[model samples]
Target: MSTPTQKHTKSRKNIRRGAIRLKKISLANCPKCKKPVKPHTACAFCGSYKGKVVKKVRVPKSLRKSKKQEKSKK
Candidate 1:
């Protein structure tokens, strides 16, 4: 295999890697639940998509905290 004859400059390297850098995740609000969600995907909190119910999600008992518990914590 042949190797590069010349050293790549930092500016050139950076320019080439510019597109490889991490990008911010674009998010859209769920119309039903008003939660941040990825575009074209169902809202995980309410299981909704495009103003319609596409999935039925059941909240587990362990994850559900009562109002009384919240008040006691504070």
Candidate 2:
């Protein structure tokens, strides 16, 4: 029966558990659209993989931005 230990501080705990640091994710540039994407994956911007179209990729409606031209009525 031996239970006598000092309390650990927040900074000490964080330093001890430093494994939670974010790991860098490596991304390759898409040849078609020149966008950063994971290797061996289809380009989300151009819907192409390795210079060939593999699937249709579309931007979400919410995120899709378009400019509309307005004409002045005389």
Candidate 3:
């Protein structure tokens, strides 16, 4: 029969297992509020996606503009 080679500690075991953490998701900017919003998801604050407003969004006219304006100019 084979005997045990060595023992492992809790801290060493944890380090060997690697850090257990949640993957961060990439968030998109809200068109209406210019706030960070998850992609293909409704805004948590205003609850809006695409053009159709899913929730009430208070957007200022000045902030609203063509994001591709620079590309179009060229």
Candidate 4:
């Protein structure tokens, strides 16, 4: 059993245990899609990371077929 004064002191000590710190999130812009993304992670808009293309992105159907045909001819 602790006295009321001791209980109050313990609670006050616990209150400031984690009050002087913060976490910093790293943010960067994707060069390809020009959207914000976390550092060293693949960009959700263009599916690229660190200036390298990692994933193929989807385009609208109206533009997809014409783009594919042009590429096939090349």
Candidate 5:
């Protein structure tokens, strides 16, 4: 087994860890739904990819709610 000969300084450790930090994911708007979605992936709201419908996404009328309805309820 081998151990580090010297203790790493706080700033040095932090500098090395800076590169391991989380990176913000880049997102693109879905053309059909205008919602933020990961690029090269199907739009979850509209089920479209690259201007083509790849999957059929259906929301039942009862499940679908509008802002007007929510505001009225509130």
Candidate 6:
């Protein structure tokens, strides 16, 4: 096993620890819903990707029936 030869200074240790801190993730807005979403991925709320619907997200059972009825009628 190997170890650092000299004891690290406070600033040097702080600088290294600061660099190891977690970076905040940046999100982009969904075009359809205008909600924040991770880039290059589908929107969780609207289930859209690049202006197209790529996935179908489920709604609560109470809201689901209304949408299903409306869709069946169309």
The Cα local distance difference test for each model comes to 0.89, 0.80, 0.78, 0.83, 0.90, 0.96
Task: Say which candidate scores most in lDDT.
Answer: 6
For model 4, how does the per-residue alpha-carbon lDDT over 2-74 read when each residue is reduced to its tens digit?
6665445766777887576788887888888788899888998888888898988787798999999999999
CA RMSD of each candidate after superposition: 5.2, 6.4, 10.9, 5.9, 6.0, 3.6
Per-residue lDDT, model 2, residue 6, is 86
Better of 2 and 5 by TM-score: 5
Q: Give the range where candidate 6 is weakest over 10 consecutive residues by summed lDDT.
A: 15-24
Q: Order the candidate numbers by lDDT, best to worst.
A: 6, 5, 1, 4, 2, 3
Model 1 worst lDDT run, 10 consecutive residues: 60-69
Report the lDDT tens digits of candidate 5 across residue range 13-60.
Answer: 999999997889999999988999999899989899999999999886
Off by over 4 Å in 4: 1-5, 10-24, 60-74
Model 6: how far is 46 from its true place, Å?
A: 1.0
TM-score to native of every candidate shown: 0.71, 0.53, 0.45, 0.50, 0.71, 0.73
For model 4, the local distance difference test gives: 0.83
- Number of clashes recorded per candidate: 0, 0, 0, 0, 0, 0
Error (Å) of candidate 5 at residue 60 is 4.8
Instruction: Give the residue spans of candidate 1 off by over 4 A.
Output: 63-74
lDDT of 1 at 54: 92
Q: What C-alpha lDDT does candidate 5 achieve relative to the native structure?
A: 0.90
Model 2 lDDT per residue over 1-74, tens place:
97749888999999989977787988999987788998887888889988999998877765553322222322
Better of 1 and 4 by TM-score: 1
Better of 1 and 2 by lDDT: 1
Pairs that clash in candidate 1? none
Model 2 segments more than 4 A misplaced: 1-15, 59-74
Task: For candidate 1, write residues 5-32 as lDDT tens digits.
Answer: 9999999999999889788999999999
By TM-score, the better pick of 1 and 3 is 1
Global fold similarity of model 1 (TM-score): 0.71
